[model samples]
Structures are given as C-alpha cells and as structure tokens.
Target: MAAPKEIPLDEIQWHDPFEIQRIGGLHSNTVLFYFASSPFFDGTSNNAIVYNQAVHNENMNHLIHTREAFEGRLREMTGLEFMVAQEPAESGPGMGTGVWVIHKQTRRKREPKDEIIVHAAYYLVGDHIYMAPSFSDIVNHTMITITEKLSKCFAIADKARTWSPSTGHGYNTASATTSAKAHALESKGTTPMPNTQESSTSEAKKPTRSAVDSRLAEHSFMIHMQYGGEYMDENPITGKPGEFHLSSTGRKDKMPTLALPSLNTTMVSSSLTQPDKKDAKAGEKTPKTPTGMSKIKRKKSKAGATPTSA
Candidate 1:
C-alpha cells in the first residue's frame, strides 16, 4: 500500500477527519469536535488532532482564563514560560454576539530557536458555551479559516439541538424560535418513547449465577465420602464433612456409630494371654545317647532286644 500524501493548507477543505465525541457530565452534556488538519497537526504524527468542546450549560465559564488554561498545559509539557494577550471581538451573525480572542506564544526549554503560538476563541451560541483552542506554526489567515469552518459546523447544530428559550440565556431570537420548534415537534410525537420497562426486565433476566459463583465456588456439586462404615456428605458451604452424631431430638441417631475392625485388638489380646513359645520349648525334656556310643548302634540293639522281651 502507498502512503497517504499530505494536503496543501490553502487547497485543503479543512474538514477531513473531523470527528465528534460526547463527553459525559453530571449536570450538563459536552460535545467535542476535532479537526485533523488544523494548524495543530505538527506534521509526521498520528492522532495529532485539536478540539473545540461545546458545553451545554448557561452559567459555564467560557471566556474566562481560556488562554491561561492553554498556556498552563503547554508550560507543563514544555517547562517554559508563555506570554498571553487577549482581544475582545464580536462574533456570530453579523457580529451581534461578543467573544474573547486569546493569543499565546512560548518557546521550549531545549529549543531556543523554535517558538510556538496558540490562538483560541471563546464564544457562546444558544445554550452552549464553546471553547475553541488551537496551537500551530501556521499563519494567521490559515488559523482564521480553520476556526471559521469549525464555528459554522458546530454553531448551526448547537442552535438546533441543545438551545432552549426556557433556559432564559437567550443569545438570539433564532435560538428561541428553534427551541420552540423542536419542542412542538416533540409534542407532536416525532420522537419515540424509550422502552425502559422491557430494557430493565431484560437486564434483570441476565444470569446472576456468574456473580454468585465468583464469590462462592466456581464449580458447585455434592461430595460424598465413606468414613468407617458410614457414608458422609460434605457440606458445600462450610466445606466440612459430617461425623457420626445423635439427632437434635436426642432419641434418634443421625448417623450410625463409627467402629473399626476388631482384628487388631484380637491379635493384641491373644498375644497377652498365650504362653511364650521360647519358654515352652526350653521346658520339654529330650532323651540323649551317651557321647561315646553312636545313636544308630543303640537304636539297632533296642530293636533286636524288643522281640525277645515281647
């Protein structure tokens, strides 16, 4: 595959790779939009993007210290001092609304020859307060072109969606008119209601065994073992096997009495009662031939005399 060539700044539509993401909030919703080819793109980088975050709240601090916030972040990253200058100007719809223009310049600690300048605009459109900040090495005309495109893209949508006349922070009658129109359309059943009950039921029907098994045992089953002559079922909860014991009624036996075979005891008792084999053999008397005579000759003489004596 071939690499994608960079687009020239003037010829660029300034809208490629523009993406938006919803930033969650407890009290208000915020939408952030990024223009990929903005002056903020430092060339030869991935995810080199810049943002304009639109906060949907009336009392938001949109104009205050926006320059300082950008400088503080740059100072933290580069460890250098930044000089800031602010200018007030009219914005939106033939310069009817007011806005703050912030300009900041700084140099990195290691790069003595290099300088960075950031330009940010803070303005409100309808119910949303927008903070559009960008930093780059581009000329002022390019910066203005990029900011204008971004402002126009979000301003129209913000006026249509989040702005309401009931908010009482009206920037223009068009915002109020759009708010009323959206409310009337909604009341006329243009939007569908959420199926909250069905969603909750489905969520509840999800198996809770995985949660229980994580805390308890992953695999639950019966464990049976034979101890002595009685079969014992192990308790899965306490993981302890049962022993032979009486029932709570005291009359009935819960388990049979455990008994060992008597072969060992019988062998021990018989050994204690029987006579010693060595002592019995020593007590037995045995007839012996004279040391000088042969046993064979004595046996022959006895057999020959036995016939005459009989």
Candidate 2:
C-alpha cells in the first residue's frame, strides 16, 4: 500500500497526525483512561504507554529517565512516554502529599493502594500477550467488558493470578486478612457486626490444596499500553497480531490498552478476616450514569475519522 503524502515533520507536531479524542460532559479534570489505539502512532518503532490517574512515584521516575536515555539508545531499543492529560502531575490536594515535577511525566497507571487485589494475571508468555474476557480501565479506574475485534493487534495470552493471604486491604481481600476496623479492635475481644459475618465466611472458604490451577499460570506476553486492546487493531483484519506484525509495526501502529481484570474477592480464614468496604458511604444515594456512558466507545480508522480538540 502507498503511504500518505509526506508532510514536513515540523508541520506534523503542530497538528500533524490529524487525530484527536472527544470526551463530552466530563468534569474538566476527568481521566481519559483505558483509551488509546492509534494508527499513525502505532506504526512507528517506539513502544509507548497507557495511563490513569493512579500513577505511582516509582514508575513515573523510571519513565522520565528511560525517555532521556532512549534518545541516545535508539540503536538498541525504542521507548516512549505517555500521560493522561487530565491527571498531569500537579502539586497536591491529594492523600496528604504532593508529587514532585519529576514524577508526573511518565505515563504509568499508578495504583495508590498497596492492596494487590488480584494476583491471577495473564503476564507475557515466551513472546505473546494474553487475551481475556475483560480488563480494568484506567479511565474510570474501573473494569470494563472486552470484545473480540480488538484482540487482533495483540499477541493474546494469559497467566495464573495469585495473591498473598489476608492482604489486609480492599474488597478483594479475604476475611482472613485483617481487623474489622482500619485499626486493631480494643481489648473488649468482642468484634462488630459486618466483621463478624465476614469472619464466618472466611472460615468456610479456605482451600485445602497447596496449589490451584489457573489460566494465568499457562501463558504470557510482552506488555503494551493502549486502552483500546485488540478491538482497535488495524493490521490484522481478524485477530491475533502475531510477532511478525509486531516487528513490522512499532509502538505507533501496534499497541493495545493498558488495562487488566481483577478478581473481586478471595477466601480467608476466620482468624484472619476483615470487612469489605468502598469509598462511598453506606445507604447513600448513587449518581445516575451520564449520557456519555450509555454506550462503549469503539475506535475508527485514520482514513475516516477527524480529531476533536478534547
């Protein structure tokens, strides 16, 4: 196929690729999470990232340094940096701490919690990325459903998800994990209601076997970050963009969303139980889904789409 007219490189960055994403009705600062699958960007040799507001300090620091070095190491490797525009690194009004400028540029989905909710994951296999039913979204910082179309541009694969017991964290943690309250209970010895029920459930779910077989144990693949996944693929007409395609198309022409699925719950022992909780208050009213969320967004090809300012 013939390439598009060669526009001057300088003319391009000013507004070159000629593509943009549109997100309406969102709060000015909403994260554009799990949302990339670009044609012009993917064809190049650079490997890039998918991002969310939850970026961690370590990953951010690593990216800045890596990008600086990528300039000099192009002969050996290619890398890129990404960040969701809304969550650009800014000084605080957060968890009692502010991020230094150096930590804001790397586009990694930083998780604030130490709670490693789900361990059973599909990491890279010999050279393939695992395919799954659905994955977590960095946009809303939540999980979304998956489709067959997007699976193509990726080397689909999976792995066994595993986790440490009584992780002492969120809903995914088993009752066997921690105290009912954020802190230890008083000497009263008598625990509260929800915690009491959770303790009982945990006691019954503990597994007797030392190991359990899971899909995450069987496959693996290299990582690529784009929120769109294979459904947004352009190279493969159908699915599964094999290694040959990956070598041919660098990060720009070939990347999927940076997202994964997490198990909602884990079993625990009565002695190790804790409560399952969320940020929202109990029995409180919930907000209605806005019009924008009525349908899942699908990606369009470069030949037909126009870029939106937002």
Candidate 3:
C-alpha cells in the first residue's frame, strides 16, 4: 500500500465540525472512526448504538482529545509527522479492533517509496483504551511468574527431606509407641512391658564371650602370682609329681656331720688298773700305740698280732 503524506504539525489546522447524513432515521459519526465489525455499525438492525446521544458525544470527544495529546507529544520531540491507522482483523477471535500510531520519516531514495514505522498502539475494545504490551514487558512478566513457581517447588521439596545420620530417615517415635501399646493389650499370657524387656535383654547381653574370657584370664593370673610357688610343683618336662619332696630329700642327704673313733674293752680295763701313775717316772714309759691312727691301721694290728698273754 502507498504510504500517507508526511505533513508538518505547524501547517495542519485543527477543526471540530462534525456532520452526518441520516438515512431511514439512522446516522453514523465519522470523526476518529475506523471500519471494523462493531455493534455501532451504520446500517445494522441493532439500534442500541445511539440510544443515548449525550454518552456517544462524550466518548467521541474523549478519543479526539487523546489523539491530539499524542500527536502534540510527537511534534514536541522530533517534529515528525505521525498518523493513526486502522488495524485489520486477524483470523482468530478478539484479535482485531485496534489503532496503531505510526511515525513517518522521509527516506531519501532513488525510487519514491516511503516506509511507515509503528511507535505505539492502542486497543479501543469498548470504551476502555489499553496500551499494547512491548516485547520486553512480556518477557519480564513471564520470567517473574516462572521464578515464583520454581521457588514454591523448591520449598516443598525442602520440607519433604528428612534424612539424618543419628536417627536415620523417617523415624517416628509416636508410631512405635502406639504399636507397643497395642501389642501389650492384645496378649493373653503374662508378659513383660516393652521397657522392662528392653532392659533385661540389654543386661543379659552386657558380658560378651570375649569380655568373659578376658576377665577369667585376669583372675587366673592373679591366683598364679599368689600361690604359684607352693602348689605348682609338677616337673614341666617329665610331668612327674614329687618335685618338691625329691628336692627336700636331696638337701638333707648332702648335709655334713662330725665323727668319733671307736676303742676296745681291754684298753679301757688296763687304763683303769694303772690309775696310780703319780710314782711312775716321766721318761720310763711303756711303748704306746698312737690313738690318732686311722681305723684301718688298728684293724691290721689286731689281725697281725697273736693273742698276748694276759
């Protein structure tokens, strides 16, 4: 389509004269109007469009003022020419009925073709005018919504996590207590309480086999240290009994004793008969046998000599 002429804002004149031709008791307003499927169409059978003339006039004045203000803003900034064009209805429902405010800048080109750039858009659905969302606005809104949902999911997962080292995971004391109580009530025979049973079992298992063996070894060592020398007298190599008795007998047999010499009866009688030796001279003495001689010499003398005359 050919682009609209770019007119300077100062050269344009403002007018408010509105005229409409009535046909068959029906009239249509064309100031700031666009062609679209609306309930307020000119030749429609629905006559509620002009039910209140005062309200219709007020809506037209408001649209006129809004367009004037928007154009004044563009003129103040870059003095560029702008126009509001009707947007075509899309294929889907509720996709049409909006106006686009397009900015027109003359581009120097070899051919006479102008490009129209849309600065902003407004939707006049009923009486309300809504500004269409920009691309950045839509992206920011979607990101914020997703972040909120993700945060809620993380919070739920954190609450569900209950694993720990000491108590393990999902340990419930109340459930255990309830089961114990139920078991106690259901039994017909005499049985111990849960606490008593636990205590008895723990006490019964206090001394393990290894601990008992260690204690027994310590007691035997103490007894050996106290009475080992007196009672433990068995020979280690021969396994004989009487080690202490044989040791005592050997000690007694190895003891030393004093000895005396033996004398015959004849000698004793001679000595008794010659008792008055005071008159005998010291040198004139009979030959006497040495009494210090060993028993072997005395025995030989006895055997060699014949019986002496009495």
Candidate 4:
C-alpha cells in the first residue's frame, strides 16, 4: 500500500460533489458514489445519506473525502478547525485501518511533541467503517443493565416473602395452607361415626367381674329352688336366719366331706415354749422363776394342814 498523503488544513478545498467525483473517480463500493446517486445529497452540504454511506464503505478515497467534507462543514457552521488523520494499523487483525478525528487547542504549526486530543475514532474492517464507543457510553450502558437486573431480583424476593402476625416472616405460605387443607380433607374422608348395633354387640362380647357374695347368693337361690325349699325360714344345720336351705331328700344326695390331717398337741406346745431367734437378736431377756417352794411341795403342805387350820 502507498503511504498516506497529508493534506494541509489551508489547502483542503470546500467540499464539492462533482469535483470529488471528477478527481477520485466513482465506484459502486465508494461512499462518494452513493452520495452522488442519492437524491437527498446537496452538492455543498453533508446529509444523512452521505454520512451513512461513508460509515458503511471502506475505500481509501472515500475516507479522505468524508474527512474533507466533515472539516469543511465544521469550519462553515462552527468556525472550528477540526482536523482528521488516518492512523496506521496497530499490532492485531482488523486494526490496520483507523482514522482519528482530532480537535487541537491551538492553530499554530503542528508539533511532534504536542498532545493530540481525539474527538472521535473510526475503525475500518473488511468492507465497513465503525465508530468506536466512548468510555462514558460503555459505563452508562453497564450501570443501566445492572440496575435492571437488581430491580427484577428485588421483585421476585418480595413476591416470595410471607408475613403473619403470629408466625412472623416466612416463605411459601400458599403451599403450607394447601397442605393443611389436604390433611383436613383426608381425615374427614377416612373417619366415620359408630353405629348403635355395633356398640351394643361390642359391649355384649366384653367380659365383666361380679362380687363373690353375689355369686354365692345366686347359687344358694338356685339350690333352694331345685330342692323345693324356696320358702324355708332358717338353715336347719347352722341355724342361720335365711330361707335358702336344702330339703331332707336333697341333704341325702350331698357330696361327702374331704378328710383333713390332725395336728400334734406336743409339737404345738414345744413350738410355743421355744424362744424365737429374732427375739434373741433384738436383746429381749426371758423372765426367771421366783426363789420359793415348788408348786408340788406347796400343794402337799396345803393338803396336810387342811383340818388344823381354824
């Protein structure tokens, strides 16, 4: 590629469509061709069609013409010397073709050490020219996106929150209420009332206890009725004041008594006279016999003096 020719600010002529086309030649892919063909393009003024065509094309002559027209328009309208410079591509793909439109602080001779302040930058890649976004624009867009996402999150959290006077804050109240209702319905469907016949049958099937005296009274009444002694005044054997007794014929049919073993009198006396081991351990003392005549001697003396005593 040929080196870019620097056009002096004083030498740049006023933008003229016919002159630019006559010098640079027109092509289908050129911004100038589109501008010439567009009905809205006036010979002296920049219009939307011409500007958009410049942005969409990548021709080198188109870039020069666009810069010239911009500078002329700014000089005519704002009286500012806004210069445009084509910079060499940097070290990466699609970085080769870039144009930096700059605004200078002073109109003196251009110095190599002077700081160049960029007003805007345009990048050419493949068949199009794109304006680079400023830092402020990127920051503003990121802040807006974060704000929108936070708002959505807050809305969802608010909807999930549940509040009650008794339970305080919780989540998913609707599901809890649904589960309670389901449990109530299930209990209602499963439980039934007890029937009268069923209750009566159950009571009849259960066993009950009776007093011993009441059972004996019932048996005595049955015995009296079977022996034809229902109106008897007293029991003949025990002399008890009762009408329940067996007749003579029923007494003959009674069962024999069971034999009981007899207890030994000597064994009973020996057991009663013996001192218990528990009483001996408790420190109990046995009473001693009085110092006097024996009972036998006393009885003999009483017998011998029976008549002498007056």
lDDT for each candidate structure: 0.41, 0.32, 0.46, 0.49
Model 3, residue 85: distance off in Å is 3.9
- Please say which candidate is ahead in lDDT: 1 or 3: 3
State in Å the error of residue 95, model 3: 12
Residue 20 in model 1: lDDT: 26
Per residue, candidate 2 scores C-alpha lDDT tens digits across 47-122 of 3332221134554434323333322232233233222222223435664332111111222233552221222122
TM-score of 3: 0.27
Inter-residue clash pairs, candidate 3: none
**What is the per-residue lDDT of model 1 for residues 183-295, given as tens digits with 9 covering 90 to 100?**
75664457577697998799898856444544343232222122335554442234236854433433555787889755555556656766666666766654343344456
- For all candidates, the clash counts are 0, 49, 0, 1
Q: What is the lDDT of candidate 4?
A: 0.49
- The worst-scoring run of ten residues by lDDT in candidate 1 lies at 24-33
lDDT of 1: 0.41
Off by over 4 Å in 1: 1-5, 16-18, 21-40, 43-70, 76-93, 96-106, 109-310
Better of 3 and 4 by lDDT: 4
- The lDDT, on a scale of 0 to 1, for candidate 2 is 0.32
lDDT of 4 by residue, 1-310 (tens): 9999985322222233564455464322244333334332244433333455556766422544554554443333322133334434464778754332222212332445434344444333332334456678789889999999999999988876755434556676777869988975664546685696989799788653333444566787788789964464443444356854443434455698999866467645655786867667555665343334243333345554654554
